[model samples]
Target: MAPTHSDHHHHNDGKKPPPKLLTLPTILTIGRVAAVPLLVATFYVDSWWGPNATTVIFLAAAITDWLDGYLARKMKQGTAFGAFLDPVADKLMVAATLVLLCTKPFEAGVFGQAPWLLTVPAITIIGREITMSAVREWAASQDGKLSEAIAVNNLGKWKTATQMTALTILLATRDGSLIGEGTLLASGVVLLYISAWLSAWSLVVYMRKIWKVLLM
Candidate 1:
């Protein structure tokens, strides 16, 4: 039997109440955003113990990025506010990781290459985000339709998963004393490049769709 829109909403309503801006997922997302500072602290603290502590905290924060989304969906508590906070949380997390991962006492040991190379992935991700955001805003302005920023893409998911995994592994080697440091760093480098490539391709795919709408 085909489900009517009313039937869908009816079922959904019984499962959960409407999400408020101050709901669990929104709070979790904000927590993730706030973790960026602690991530940065690890790089600049100039103490062996501090970096390790910071790394652990950063990993916990990154894990929450996934947790909040899963909880929001499972609980049928995805609010408009959650939608806004999630991406902002993600961007800040990635940006913080890149900055910290490329800094002294960690970059060479964990990156397997010059710290500067990390910038390639950073720029790629940031560029796509900025471009796609502008395209969506432009479309909304022209059409008077309030499409809350562009929806997430599959490639974006892949990029995030790979990036977080790479960062996690890289951070786990914080003391520059972990076994397979070279192998881990090499893997991280590969993941970073792959992520960058995907980011660029995803941008093209998103832009193409937006262009069609604009041309029409």
Candidate 2:
């Protein structure tokens, strides 16, 4: 039977309120976290069951990240836990994939020649996330101001979208399908380079914003 809105709404209302443990966004964030193991499994489950499947799974996981945020905002169900966990889940998933994609065994077969080339863009994306996360934490501790405007940026969202698209294409190309191997790999590489530029630009912008605050 389908659960009614009222039933779902009150499901976690009974809990105490500081952290607000079980909001819809938190549930979505948890879903993203849960997907990481599946992503890892896709790479290691034998050549017959390789990155082709993993690419689709990872894309679905990325979609959940966006869906949860939209639903939370639309339904007014956002929570502090969601805020904390969502970005962490995204970071962990991206970082893990980057590491896996650069290493031997998996990297050799899946990404083909010069697997380490992927790391240039991977580092750009991951570095921005880490730097921004640290800056936000430092500001919150020192000034007790943790505004959404301060933490979220449009360029950051664009970077995620582009990065995910690129990764999915690259992963799918691992199957060596003619179309995937040729055009898709080229496209993914182009997208990745664009994402890296965006990530770097956004990082500078975020740092400048925080710097302004600190100077004042």
Tell me each candidate's TM-score. Answer: 0.79, 0.79
lDDT of each: 0.74, 0.76
Q: Where's the lowest-lDDT run of ten residues in candidate 2?
A: 102-111
Model 2, residue 114: what's the lDDT? 71
Per lDDT, the best of the predicted structures is 2
Per-residue lDDT of candidate 2, residues 124-213 (tens digit): 778877887787777667764434337677987788888888878767766565453676777887888898899899878877776676
Misplaced by over 4 Å in model 1 are 1-19, 105-115, 144-151
Quote model 2's TM-score. Answer: 0.79
Misplaced by over 4 Å in model 2 are 1-20, 104-115, 144-151, 178-180
Q: Please report how far candidate 1 places residue 176 from its true position, in Å.
A: 1.0
Candidate 1 per-residue lDDT, tens place, 1-216, comes to: 898998888777886654467878889988888888877776577677776777687788777878888999999888898988888888887777776766543456444446567676777777777777787667667654334334557987897788777777767665666778777767877787788788888888777666665566
Question: What's model 1's lDDT at 216?
Answer: 62
